[model samples]
Target: MKYNEIKNYLNGKFVSGMGEKYDVYAPINGEIIGEFKAATKAQLDEVVAKAKAAQESWAGLTAKSRSKVIYKYRELLMKYREELSVVNCEENGKSMEEAYAGVDKAIELTEFACSIPQLISGKTQDVSKGVNCKEERRPLGVVASITPFNFPVMVPHWTVPNAIALGNAIILKPSELTPISAMKMAELWEEAGLPEGIFNVVNGGKEIVEGICDNKDIVAVSFVGSTPVAEIVHKRGSANSKRVLALGGAKNHIVVMPDANKDAGSRDIISSAFGMSGQRCMAVSVMIGVGSIDEVYGEVVAKAKNMVPGVDLPPVISEAAIKKIEDYLDYAQENGAEIVVDGRKVKTDEGYFIGPSIIDWGNSKKMSSEEIFGPVLEIRSANTIAEAAAIQNESPYGNAAAIFTQNGRFVDEAIREFQAGMLGVNIGVPVPREPFSFGGIKDSKFGYGDITGVSSIDFWTNLIKITTKWNPEHKVDWMS
Candidate 1:
């Protein structure tokens, strides 16, 4: 089941592609499971052409009809959920449970897109005389999605299904690390009667990514990656006047109040800090606590230390990532960051594992003010809740910030004062509902929201408004 041999989809058939090849490995065990063909520029161009050709008919379909295909695709995905989950786990190295959850989330997004037909319905407006007007969502010709590796299935599920349901032909460039699941899902979409090239998967690294972003045939580009990469893609794509939605990294924080229950805060912090091995963009990287709650905050540190890291929870995606985590931890310690918990020392069965890391954080020049994408949490002490909130607002990344408190007044104040894109009350991770938009302020996100909400549909399609006005007596030449 090598990735290259698996199939490169274009024009509806699984074709043996001619391109540079790379082997895909399971991050947990470091075993080569398959190979993937890096798409040649020629191949990408062909994909873009096919997508354009197919989009004409696909975009012409009524939103209701487009929604039906998405519905069928959702049904197919649901039926094969287990199989898809297994593939996701084996390749992405996430725990079996988390892998299954990711698949379900993708399914959930598909269902959300199913409801877009009504959500995207145009609004009518009245003009003077015998006039009626409306504005409707129109597909953006051909759109390209460049997804990340963290939640391989889930990320694409957020973009692809919605884009297709909105009547756009899609050319997807899934992460090279976990490309198999995406390719297989495209197969399932084909089974659901998607037209050839209506949904295409091209595998590659920067070449393919840049090609998709720069191609004029791709009317829009949607990206989910690091802030630097997102910035670059946004710049290049926008220079060409393509609609670009580039979501970047996040540095999330959780603030604990003196009056809050330490037990509850500990539990939430543990889950939010280490879930998916802290590979998520919304993972809590910093913890700020009022001085009065220092003892309670120590409990948070103790809990983070106790979390078991291994093949059971999925290792960081690659050896390179593990190394990066190591370098960051070393740098933090050298810069006076207290090593509360060292994940590098954690024991594991067979896979790449780092237990969890916690640092007594300070506002030193060397201590990171940005997001750390690993099982690491930094604890910062503040003299007052106001001081803690001030520190959080001063950080460069404003993706998500949460507060643990029983006081409605405090929660209200924090919500009103927080500078982050997402805010949480008692909740550690502040990811919004599927119907609500997900993005961040500052460096956390670029352009607009990515998935599962109105903003996402807007990202995939353009809105056009029509206004009509006519007086019966002044009406020009009726075709009788």
Candidate 2:
């Protein structure tokens, strides 16, 4: 009953997590903030049953009625933005500004979900004389979302609001490390008068994730995590014929052409590469210099060198994350690559902190290939645009790639040639806003469709085609 006691939410009330208890930490100080019992496998059936019961009435409501509830949720999200930001910062190691950005993104997605009444409508057409055909998108029943720790609030909101707004009941299984934001949002939903069982949150680790994937009643799943787990989720979820859209890790690349605005390129690469401490899937970890782009590279290094932890960068997620990044930096050292910034020396006594580190291209496989998932940026130089594009293509991840150039022809060429699902010309972080959609290609994402925006409509719903004839066709035709 105490605040910060993490629990599963069902029927508009806090249902205590009944599985193995896991300690939640405040990443900044590595302090035990709370504990959550992982939802047991035994709880899956009951959870699905509740979701089913709530979804029936929910689906029966007109789209307008659903929009009203979504509007209320959006209002509450905005009202509690500061409170949510605090929790997000405590658990996820994001700076207050970054935490606020996460909450704002969640609110933006909720606003997008509120427009479902208009965006989710079906199409009608006349196929034959005296016959009319139409298609309607129906809810996929009880569904689930497995979000990562990187963007706790925004990622959960990614699938939950959109799926539920379209009439499905959704179960949110947030990462155990950062369940506070989701649990807090669950409370907000209750206050917003969302019907019991319509929105649920099951807090836990991998077991609960497997429980979600294996639960027969859960017809669809949306997951955001590393590549290996994303592939597993997609495969396991698909084996059961479940609809799945799993977003995975990325080693995103940003190209800085010689003609690019030096100041803008410096600012953007630093923001994109080091923002959120480089944990996000859209974070650009690799920067490719096309031709003699030394000015921008030097400027980026100059700007990054002075970045103090807790101001310019959030604390690293955990000691484990710090070690992983350290190991990769060691790889650069072994390969004799110049460490331009040396993030290892930047430290704080109270928390896991790594300052922005820039390394000139190591020419090592792991340096160019693996996703370090920390604030380590690698600078690669290419002789031409084709070489730059090739460098990006060499990576297996096709999540996102950006090019900073003012020339329209180069921008157009980059768009066509870049081997990525999401491409940006001048923008560093190419995360598509609401209505535009966000996703990547190849190992970066699995299954079909983007995770948000209009593309998500298909992932969370089922389409039905209806045909009726008032009278028999006068003549036989292929349509008839």
| Strongest candidate by TM-score | 2
In order of appearance, the predictions have TM-scores of: 0.95, 0.97
TM-score, prediction 1 = 0.95
Per-residue lDDT for 144-232 in model 2, tens only?
A: 99999999999988898899899999999889888888889898989888999999888877888888888888999999999999999
Instruction: Write down the lDDT that model 1 would get.
Output: 0.82
Any idea what lDDT model 2 has? 0.87
Minimal lDDT window, size 10, model 2: 361-370
Candidate 2 C-alpha error for residue 179, in Å? 0.5
Per-candidate clashes, comma-separated: 4, 0
The true-structure Cα RMSD of candidate 1 reads 2.8
1-480: candidate 1 lDDT, tens digit per residue: 444365578878776557778888887778888986787989889878977988999889898888878889989988999989988888888888998889888888888889988898778865545677899998888998899999889988778888899999988888888888877887799889888879988888988888987788898888888999989999999999888888888878788888888788888888888888889988888888765777567787777666776633568888777888888889888888889788888746566677788888665545677566888888787776787788788787878999998999888877877789889999988888788877888887667664557788878888898877665656443421
